[model samples]
Target: MNDSDDDFSRFAWHTAEQRAAQGDSRQVADLAVELTHRIEAAAEQTRDHEHQLAHLVRVLAITPGHDSLTQLLRLFTRSQGPGVGLAPRFVASLLAEHREAADLVGPLSERDPKGRLDELRICLLHELILRGVDVDAFPKTIDWTRVKYGDHPLVWLPRRRSPLETRVVFPSRAINSSAHPGGSVLPKEGRLDPPTPRTQERSALVDTATLDLHQMIVSAPEAGGWGHSEAWVFRADEEVEPDRVPALLPTLPMGCVEGLGATSRFEIARRPADEIWSLLFATASIGIGHDGAHGAFGRLWAWKSLAALSDAPADASAEEVEHHVQQTTWFHFESDAEWFCNEIFADYGIAALSPDRRRIAVLAATATD
Candidate 1:
């Protein structure tokens, strides 16, 4: 091998070995990319190319992505010890952050003035909500319109509204004071009557509810599926103290928040709130709606419902709760959501009375209130 090629190979090998030793999966995942290049370069003349390819294959298989990539990096790096270099860690962080942005943006553009301004505000509000922000405290009324693209008249449009931006909206006190904290709109009892299984499968987007809400949210969507790279709407709801935040939503910009029924200038769609809530809640699970019908609204609702329930709390039997509480999956998603929801409710000093108390209070408040 020439000096430069040999130098690249040696550096790649050394970094891979260091990451492997340090147990840095993030580094290892990155090294997987580097090794891809090395394997290509080595393919032309090196006799050891086969061995290198096998090793690279093995590395990719061992790495886990369902869990937080950051956690994966921490565990892998800690296991490998301090001798590992810092370069892989930096690269891993950047790639992960960029991927998250791509997932949220979802083929959106900033070229159109109106679309650009709206997207920016949406992102800014989303950020504020992430930090336990109170948009209600903001003075201006935020207006957003849901636009369709690649559908008839708008097919050639430059900036199209994302399914999400078209659906979720800011909570106005006059409208959504009693809206569900997350995207869920379960009955006052917070219990589903029970879902009867359907016989036929529909479109990939519509029929994707075969898996549980948590599974759908945490797992990657198949090719040409919902096109959602990742779902992170579920935040801890239990930890926020009373008055600290209104609600710790499982997903921010709750999918049901989109398109108010108001006769305002920024009306996106004319769907009703109860209908939107019902459609999303049911579709995420059994994939049904209030009228038990199917439509684009159902699909969108299903997606957000799953995202919301990824953080839904359960009051399981003592034995079941105890057994599940110890499991890694349970600890990560189930418990985390429960704790998050509880914290948010606590922070807001939302009373934790029985369903009877809640129902009476909600009933007492006028629709305007």
Candidate 2:
């Protein structure tokens, strides 16, 4: 390495990261461009290449777009600590944040044949969706199991409206208010008839997805301990209205809010169905809770929960996921009322009516103390 490279290796990038953290967007972008040059020009056969790449990977957080994504992926292998698996998350975030990164996902299995990029693949899909790109429109990458969710793309084009094959019973109002302090649609009796066949089937899928979420595989994050999640299903007596779900949800029984008075009351607001996955993925995403790879549990849970709710097979595709979500009438809720509370922050949930409106699935999670 030359004297200037030595100066950068010893002092420059650290200050770059510090400046980036201190709100220097220009410095971050400039550092990313510089690091890409240094890392790319270094030969893989060079004795110090991996060492140089490993130490400099930390600067990725300073910027995105022109960050040394592909180069770093090929050269870096070490982590700051054992079991950290920090590289994939950084690569994933860099990919998601980079304006030109969307093209990288279509060739998953070959690019990451050993599955090193799994979680990043999932997050990139998410970020692209947020950008309003039609991910299902991407060319079929045949037989790559996990990214497909379990199937090939099916809902790439909007299907003509048809009565759904799956159905659920419409809920009766246990609480009538949609204002501050929402009310439950659960019966005052606080119980339902025996579990329906639909419940058993969806639960089986959920259980299986849950198991995968708990695995300590490369790039896949474990189940999160920072929040509480639960599922409750009820048979509807009438047609369930999706817009009214914020009031009809069984928030009290779901432990989303404390029921202190004679009636269960908490404030709740509905979020767009397309938006919930990102909102859930955002929980505890920075600083100590989600340092690099560790904070990934949130995204895993978000992906798994929605997939399970749709009864999506392990190989289900993004298009099919879109179809199922459209078939199902679901509400994603955000609340700050005293009754709608998490251990340390606001609580949110999904109250979904099975396609036929015969079964209602209510799933909720709240950050804990």
Candidate 3:
């Protein structure tokens, strides 16, 4: 080897050994990138190229730096032959980051064969969700199965059970409130029934909205866990005027807020007022759930019914009110109302409006009278 190449090899080896011994992942990643370059250059002349490359891959796999992981993935794609396998553990680790997994989607898909590509993508998706990516953005048709992460097989997605036969019972005051024009048009018990199946394709706009909502929800401190009962209710009246929505909603100087684990950025889409309202309601109440359940489905129907109620006259009948409430109810049992209020509503200035557009209810578990 030439003097310059020999010097580089020596430096790479020394750095790798030092960083590995110290367990410095960032420094190890840096050294791994340098070694990758050396390995590529010496591919034709060096007999030790495979050993060097293997070491580089191993270091990069364990490194927490996303840039280093990306470089390693790119190198693996370029250098490894078709028959060779990329390390599943390495791929899984890198995919634990939302941005990294998203970046890999196209490249991994293009490089690996169909079945292998699907497997890798599935693994990446699984990790992304676990890391708090929005559930609404997940691919709808996932054939879930366990893949080996190390010695153990890991399940990325579990099959959901059949929808529950349930109803949403509104508070007596809320049912009798002028928010519903028709007197007691709802069931005698003031409950909203479950929604019918929807055949319409979800809009891409809704997808974007859902992603934002997911980020906001997951970033909140108290968002995760089962049986969270906190909720907020807000209302906006037609007399308020559509142009005032921005002023009425919360505003952050840069449209971003920092919470417990991650920073959340939000933007209200410039759509018609009604469309925007519906989109936000649907995305927040139903689409943000980690899994499909009766609660989410019921919330979707409830929002739709609320929209219909907004159009009904104030003197609407009990049956009419019941019909609307039954059309929509809370579906997400795991929803964090405090998180929604603090992170979503408080940050974004969102208020939930009654069907008549006369009242906004901000229900939250943390709310104090």
Against the true structure, whose TM-score is highest? 2
C-alpha RMSD of each candidate structure in angstroms: 23.0, 16.8, 20.8
How much lDDT does candidate 2 score?
0.43
Output the number of the lDDT-best candidate: 2
Please, what is the TM-score per model? 0.19, 0.47, 0.23
The models' CA-based lDDT, in order, is 0.28, 0.43, 0.35
Residues 147-219, candidate 2, lDDT per residue (tens digit)?
A: 4233312222122211221111111111121111122222223122221121111111112223342231111
State the lDDT of candidate 1 residue by residue for 1-369, as single tens digits.
Answer: 233757666756677678677887675676567667777877664647544533333233234443333432343234333213222222222222223433222222223332323322233333333223344544341332232221221112112222222343221111112222232222233221112221122211111222454343422121112212223222232333322111221122322222312221110111223333333323231221112112222233333332332232343332332232222111011112212232211101011111111110000000010
Stretches off by above 4 angstroms in model 1 are: 1-113, 144-215, 219-330, 333-369
Q: Give per-candidate clash totals.
A: 38, 27, 41
Minimal lDDT window, size 10, model 2: 165-174
Q: Which stretches of candidate 3 lie over 4 Å from their true place?
A: 1-55, 58-71, 74-85, 97-101, 114-119, 135-156, 159-369
